[model samples]
Target: MHPKKVQKLIYFVFCCLFTLPVLAQNRVVTGRVTDAKDNSPLIGVSVVAAGSATGTATDVSGNYRITVPASATSVVFTYIGYTRKQVTITGTTLNVTMDAAGTALNEVLVVGYGTVRKKDATGAVQKVNAADFVQGVTTNPLQQLQGKASGVTIATTSGDPNSSPTVRIRGTVSLSGNSDPLYVIDGVVGADIRSVSPNDIASFDVLKDASASAIYGSRAAGGVILVTTKTGKAGTPQITFDAYTAAESPLHLLDFADRTQYLQAYQQFYGKPMPAGTSTTSDQGANTNWFKLITHTGISHNESMGISGGNEKGHYRGSATITISKEMCAHLS
Candidate 1:
């Protein structure tokens, strides 16, 4: 053969070798992607042939058709919020059923600036839902969180009902400055916790480490408390009412000496009869049970009402709460 003819023949063989694979990939594979739980068609699902760059997406009807090489044995299907699926190409028709992904692990959490999935959150975060709140009358919203979270301390500084509870996250950090964690309610920084009733709250997201300082700055040196309130949902009008009443009484009373016992004790100690008009005012003939006069039963009552409704365009929610508490010796003690 001539040398020029040989070069032409080699060039033709190389082109054929490259084109043969492309020509052999003409096998058509059709399939439908549907949710495994609901059997509903899933739209915008990605369909790709195994070990090949050829891919396509399912249409609105969740129907997909793709061309694959004859050697391709399996096809891959993927969709957002659904698990990835692989189907064997037994024949030309390849149907795929995808299961929902993430389950409870995909729950969304509200951070300082944005939201993150529960599994994706790297910081020390704890979430408390209203459903888990303590069942009973709560003088303050913070009281409901007592003993619910780890590495957190909630205590009342005094018995005063109006006093806010002392909240310490991961123990106290500051010696001079305020050690209380920063409170973020409904995206509002430094909002007073007293303004929000426990009945109106949906959840509490507590960032309990230095990671919180990165989001809220130095004030969050102690930690951060993110409060998410309840909002309206897309549904018919709904109204709710809640009310409760509680009574409190002193568990024990201190023992005190009567007039006769006091006189006898004073005589025994001083070796003399009690002097008249002494520090002992009982000498003036007044026998008063001060403890009995000062203390009484305390009563507390609370009521809450809320209404919510909306449509696809917008939603609205209104809520109100009333709390009345009268404690025994609240001012005298």
Candidate 2:
């Protein structure tokens, strides 16, 4: 071929290679979240991309703007005390309305060996939803009960993970015979709330007062804690996973005497001569970092996975969860 023809052919090949189409870039998405009943804007609502970490929250005015990958097809909206909603986006501008979450008043509440409605209850009772449990912390479910209900006090005398907290409702009513409430899990008595995984709990109900406690007989004086495990729902199989990892360290440390200072003080106070090879220097021969040698940051992790679904007959649900935590203490000696 002629040189001009060859050059022309090469130029055509390069142009074709460069002309390949490029993927579309993600666009800015904006929207407003509001309550379905009142038409009032919802503020500080969490708007997240489904199955991903990309998300943002609604501003004080209930307005939200987020940049999502072009591949995102759906987004999830959630707020406390509100039902979660998922929306498919086709354009930049979206408007959403969320429904109020149903409570025990609309659902069933477990009582002594039976169930009842919240409005008809004649006892001092409190209920907590499973969805409200902390996702990734090693703390017990009772720890989350603090400030969640009225007239319920859960105090942790010590920070031991395996230790149970003291739970009191409307003050203690018994002088002995177990001042703590009776724990019932899934219709079984004497259940340890700590043993059951928090992820497995569907709901928790606290029964107080004689009207509610009388059903349990002798076990009622201390009150009652009822736990219900998650059950299956009818529909397509749905899977959910929650994972968390955390590290905790002392924010402040108290200053104390080092080995040399301690030994010197001992000798001076006792009016005894210094040991043969002992030095009075403030800096000990070998740096003894008491805190470093004795203590380290605590680490905790939790993982949970659940599957729910059903056919025409009935629903089936299953879940498993594991959590581990290690806490180290500083040796004052």
Q: Estimate every model's Cα lDDT from 0 to 1.
A: 0.85, 0.79
TM-score of model 1 (CA atoms) = 0.74
Worst 10 residues of 1 by lDDT: 278-287
> Per-residue lDDT for 8 in model 2?
98
lDDT of 1: 0.85
Q: Taking the tens digit of each residue's C-alpha lDDT, what string does model 2 give over 88-172?
A: 9878988999999885325556678577766777777778886665444646768766667677788988667778889987788
Point out where model 2 deviates above 4 Å: 1-110, 113-117, 131-136, 157-163, 258-289, 330-333
RMSD to true structure for each model, in Å: 6.2, 25.5
Give one digit per residue, the lDDT tens place, for model 1 in 243-270. Answer: 9999988899877887878878989998
How far does residue 164 in candidate 2 sit from its true spot (Å)?
Answer: 3.3
Q: Relative to the unseen true structure, what is the Cα RMSD of model 2? A: 25.5
Q: What is the Å distance of residue 183 in model 2 from its true position?
A: 1.5
